[model samples]
Target chain A: MKSVKAFAPATVANVSCGFDILGFAIDAMGDYVEVFRKEEPGLKVISIEDDGGKLPWEVEKNTCAVAIQAMLDDYGQEIGMDIALKKGLPLGSGMGSSAASAVAALVAANRLLGDPYERKDLLPFAIVAEKAACGAGHADNVAPSLLGGFVLIRDYHPLDVIKLHVPDSLYCTLLHPHFQLNTSDSRSVLRDAIPLKHSTIQSGNVAGFVSGLYQEDYELISRSMRDVIAEPYRAVLIPGFYEVREALKAAGALGMGISGSGPTLFALSKGAEKSKEIAKAAEEIYQNIGLGVDVYYSAINTRGAYVLEENK
Target chain B: MKSVKAFAPATVANVSCGFDILGFAIDAMGDYVEVFRKEEPGLKVISIEDDGGKLPWEVEKNTCAVAIQAMLDDYGQEIGMDIALKKGLPLGSGMGSSAASAVAALVAANRLLGDPYERKDLLPFAIVAEKAACGAGHADNVAPSLLGGFVLIRDYHPLDVIKLHVPDSLYCTLLHPHFQLNTSDSRSVLRDAIPLKHSTIQSGNVAGFVSGLYQEDYELISRSMRDVIAEPYRAVLIPGFYEVREALKAAGALGMGISGSGPTLFALSKGAEKSKEIAKAAEEIYQNIGLGVDVYYSAINTRGAYVLEENK
Candidate 1:
């Protein structure tokens, strides 16, 4: 194919008890990337759209360009490629915007190279792009975006990413308040040392949550979706955080927690209707705080990144 | 029935990554308790056997007697009961010996009182018995001993115990070297606070381990069977721990870890043959150290405590 266009879903990481380990993909919003093969021996970003002029225009700084470059370096190909990125997810919203961009680009580039690598094999390249984007090659977001569905990053040294079972009727609600919590600032609010008691509780919840998924027990999932390590400290950075959580809980969300860091929150429920209701409740809370909110409801996405279009 | 005799299986707690929360019952060694209804309105310990005469004979301090008393107190029964205890498991062997005694006693007393409470309802009584015996009501041992199979003690305050899926072919090998590490001394060696980095790794292993159990993926189970928090410090308490772990791994054991405290070690393998081999390897390691060791091999026990006999 002369050209390829791909889509990668957004993801919710630090999923309550699964901080730094668990994440899931959402079907509501994502990023799209189109890569064009060129005869000229160079790589460049031809255009970027819907980024509100905040994303970098330079090729080395952009997630898509960096991801494609990583793929090209590993493939040892001197071929030229032009890239176009369209952002459906908001930047700095804890919706895995950068990861989606990088994953989408890698998906397109791999297809344009005549499928040199399988989908799961593209993770390292995506991690390289993540390192270029956020100073840490965290696979929590990138793995789900690339592999789809629920993912557990079992280990990092060798990059073990496991795809876990997702209940059929599970739905997610994302509420992004109109503000920004820098990832570094959000991380700085966390304690470097945690009590062993809290660690044990967190492990129990993690085990319970995973068990609930396999058993398809929604009540167990709700009871297990608690974040003792990060949410308590990060909640203080977001206005009306606890109130919004209570509102979501009252509105029938199974559980709610900070999606990635702050300024955006996510919840889970049994059906799309309950998810929508939760979104409405969260929107009202953000509205009461005099901040606009963007809400999206979706079932858990089982398909991660895919080729949207191809040209002969 | 005027008298009832019951048996409770032994258990291996901590199960690697699930320290303070996870355990599984084994079908090998256990404790037996026989409760006889009497005319007077008091509780008494009539006989004890196979306990090396070290076990307390007083009704107040004995585990079986204490457990039966807790059940009677909760049942609000003004009846006399004579308890006969027989120990199949060693004392201070890290094999849930005390828990087995308490569970066996509770099972017998429950049957003698016509079973007002279901089997699972006996957990709190078992915890009370544990508190009387060890000064803390830790449920990792008692939960599996009472509920059977694998269990997760998800919460302590409300005392939530969850039964987990145990792979049908899973077998256990227990190696008890000739020594005793006091539970309090083993606990005192652990750090009260752990770095957040270690906690995250621990949570990842716990989630992966549960997922592996449900999926029945033995390779994943082996990979996830790691204890970063407790094993590092506790390994020093047991001589030749690291070498024995390597031998178990080489002998095709899926994973190995300290049973509950120290001196006793447990390894999990897929089949009976592999479990026996692992046991042999562990035995050689302890024998070379000039210590006599006791080894038991059995499949995962699905039935916890049961009535072995009844008299009319």
Candidate 2:
């Protein structure tokens, strides 16, 4: 595989209570990229499309370019690569749009370089690239884009990453309100202090969700995913957040919460049919609020990052 | 199988960062009780001993009696039984003294009642009984005593419980300094509100520990068991806590933290040699503080509440 093309799917971080540490991939929505090895000695940005004149093309500001540069820097081989990114997921949409691009570029670059780097080795580079784009080093988006399934960013220092088995019965319905919420702005709006009791409650939910994944207890997992700290405060910024969640719950959705930084809300359900119902209900709720909405029904992607296609 | 007597070991709650949600059993360091059916219309507290007259004999004030009564009240059965308490772990030692009595009595009673109820079925009863003793309904202790191993009490409502596999290479060393830190008093000292940044850090540690347990990464588990929110503030009351933890860590102990509330400190290690070293170092630290100390080395108890000896 001298040169290859890959698609890294967009992801939902925070999965309710698991902020900064937990994430899952969405298969249908993602970014596509292509890479080709060059005899020259430096990573070169070939082209970018569908960014709506928003993303930067510079090596420092471009997520794909930064990721490839980091990988080349780590490998100590100044092998050059021509990369192209077609951004499919919307930018700054709380849907891991940048992470998908960074992951896809790094994965394609790693393949172009005779597979010199392991997939896990690419996480930090992707995180760094994401940091350059979002101005924060959060693994919740990058981990899922890189490793698939439900990835737990155990510790960022030594980078302890664990792939969790998502239950087959679990399905997600994402409602993107067609609004942008910058991760930095959302983070800044959050309170600098939280009640200790609220923190304890959130921790309990996180533990329960992780354990529920292990036990395949959907009921427990849903009950445990409630977030009292970040979501309660962040939801204030997202229109129809509470109404959508309550409507979905009333419509038999198991659990619901803001996906990552907000403006994008997700509901967890027991099956595809229920997930569809949830999506329909969420779209209606958003429409009632006079906002455009894009809804996707997806299952937990077990495969993390992978090469979708290759060219000779 | 006509009659049975069982002993449920005591537990240490709040296992560091896992406040109100995590606990583990201590081997041979708990209350012992026996239960046998009698041909009577109501439950009876037959006898109590070795409790230093600290506990009440009235059924309402007795932890064991109240627990059994809750079960009886729920079932509305005319079953009667005799309960004997052999208090081995001292009261008010931050060692879950009340949880032990509740668990042992419930286990014995359940067995005497032909074991009709599942262990989880008895959790709410035990928690309610615990509230009668401690004035709060918390499961950090009761869950471990009932389930064994390291337990994460994810939620009280609908009961989200996750039991992580305890690694065999791990040894628990508990050092109880001669002092009393009432759970309520210790709880009162805590600031009702905490800085949100600190809570986020603590939540990260919780996520790291849970992920570590799932991956069976012992080093990460030890590194991630840190408690920044509660430990610093609470450790001030426990004399020499800082010195003991420092010495143990210096002597190659994996990690150390206040066992439950305070006064009793615990450490985790891989080898028996290191566990002994930690215990010895802790003893020296406590001695330097002019406090009496008792140390115990044990592994995670997989068998939670069980019958110890049956009277044929």
Candidate 3:
């Protein structure tokens, strides 16, 4: 095939207790990347669409282009690609927009290049390329975006990623504000160090959250989906944070936390109807403050990254 | 039945990555508590066996008597018991000495009280009584000792406890030095505050370990069984810890960390034979330092607390 177009979904990283280590994919939003063969060996970004913020046009600077570059560099066969990224997800709203772009581009490139590797095998290249968007090399958002459903980043050094099971009945509700909270700024506000006690408590919650998922215990998930470290620190940055959280909880959200860096809050529940109820309550809280917010209800996206179109 | 006798296994709390939240039971050592009915409604510690140090015989102060008291106080049915403790595990050796006693006494009392509660139900009484052994009311050690296998302490306030799975092939090798590192002293050395990075990494490891258990991925469990919180501070108190850790790793051990708040180092391996090799290497390290050490190789215990004698 001369060209391929693929999409990768936005993911909820941190999952409350599992900061930098856990995430899950949702069907609500995503980004699409189209890759076309270039005559000579190189990578370039030919076009960008629906970008709320100024994204890099240069091949080396853009997440999508950089991801394609990494893939081409690793390919033993001669390859060149021109890329296009269409951002269907909100930028800097913690919905993993750049991650979607990074993952999508790598997937498209791999598709047109005779599919040299498995989708999961593309993780390393995707993670390295995602660093172009976020300064830190973290897989919480990227892994789930690539692998689908829920993923746990066991270790970072040697880079171990494990795909975890997500209950079929699980539902996700996301409320995104019109404004943006840059990933860098959201991370900068977090404490460099946390108290040992807080860490211990957070550890319990993370383990509990995982166990809840396995047992399909909604009560356990709701109780354990607490973020003692990041949420406490970043909650102040999001407007009407506490009120929205209370509203979500009151409306039967299993748990709620900052989706990515904030200006967006993601709440999870059991049924789609219940999740909508939670979404309405949470959105109303943000809307009461005269904020334009977008609420999306989703069942988890089990497919991580996939091809949408191909030209043979 | 006028009296009952039961035994509760010793447990390794913290489990390296899961400080204050995770633990597992092994088949190595335990504590046996025999409870006899008292004429009136009052608790007493009549005698203690295998006392490594002078233990409080007072009903209000001793761990065994205190656990029995808590159980009786919770029961609406009039119940009184005089207790005797046999500490098969070494006291103050980082082998959950007090937790074993606390769990055993609670089990024996519960058994003699006509099994008023389930094995898991006895957790609260054991946790409350464990405070007499260690200042803080934590259940990492006691829960696994009471429930058997591995356990996750999700929350302590409302008292949420979950029993987790353990791989049958996983083997535990513990090398306990003939020295006392009191729980109070061991805990006192820990830093009250830790860096956020450390906490996040530790959280990942804890979640990873739990995932490992479910997946039956020994490599992941070993890699994730890291203790960034407690082991660092307490490692200094133990003799020849580093050498033993290296030796164990070289001998095909998956991971090694301070068992509870050491003097005893716990190492895990893929099989019984490998665990024995790891145990030999660890033991030799302490022996070379002229410190007497006892090595116990065991599989994960599936049984929690069990009755030895009941005349019902």
Best by lDDT: 1
Q: Could you tell me which residue pairs clash in candidate 3?
A: A193-B195, A193-B196, A194-B195, A194-B196
lDDT string for model 1 (B104-221, tens) is 9999989888889999999998998899988889999999999899999888878778898989889999999988799998999899999999999999999989998899989889
Give the poorly placed runs of model 2, Cα more than 4 Å off: A1-3, A37-44, A75-79, A157-159, A250-252, A271-277, A280-290, A308-312, B1-4, B35-47, B77-82, B112-116, B168-170, B250-252, B271-291, B309-312
Q: Judge the docking of candidate 3 as incorrect, acceptable, medium or high.
A: medium
Docking class of 2: medium
**Cα lDDT tens digits for candidate 3, B96-127:** 88889998888888878678898888888888
Better of 1 and 3 by TM-score: 1
Give the best candidate by DockQ. Answer: 1
What's the true lDDT of residue A250 in model 1? 97
Candidate lDDT scores, in order, read 0.91, 0.82, 0.85
Error of 3 at B197 (Å): 0.8
Q: How far in Å is the alpha carbon of A266 misplaced in model 1?
A: 0.5
lDDT of 1 by residue, A1-312 (tens): 399999999999999999999989999889999999999976888888999999996879999988888888888878799999999988989989999999999999899989999988999999999999999999999999999999999999888889999999999999898887899999999999999999999999999999999999999999999999999999999988888889899999999999987578999999989998988888788888888889889999998999999997
Question: Please, what are the lDDT tens digits per residue for candidate 2 over residues A219-297?
Answer: 8787887888788779888887888888899877889988889778888888889999998888787778899999999
lDDT of 2 by residue, B1-312 (tens): 245666777677887778778898867577888877777766667778888888887888889989999998887787877777888788877778888899989888887777789988898899989899988888888889888888988776667677876777767888888777877777777888888766766777777677666667777778777887788889888877777888889877778888778677888887777888888887777778788998887776777888786654
Model 3 chain A is weakest, by summed lDDT over 10 consecutive residues, at: A69-78
**Candidate 2, residue A271: CA error in Å?**
4.3
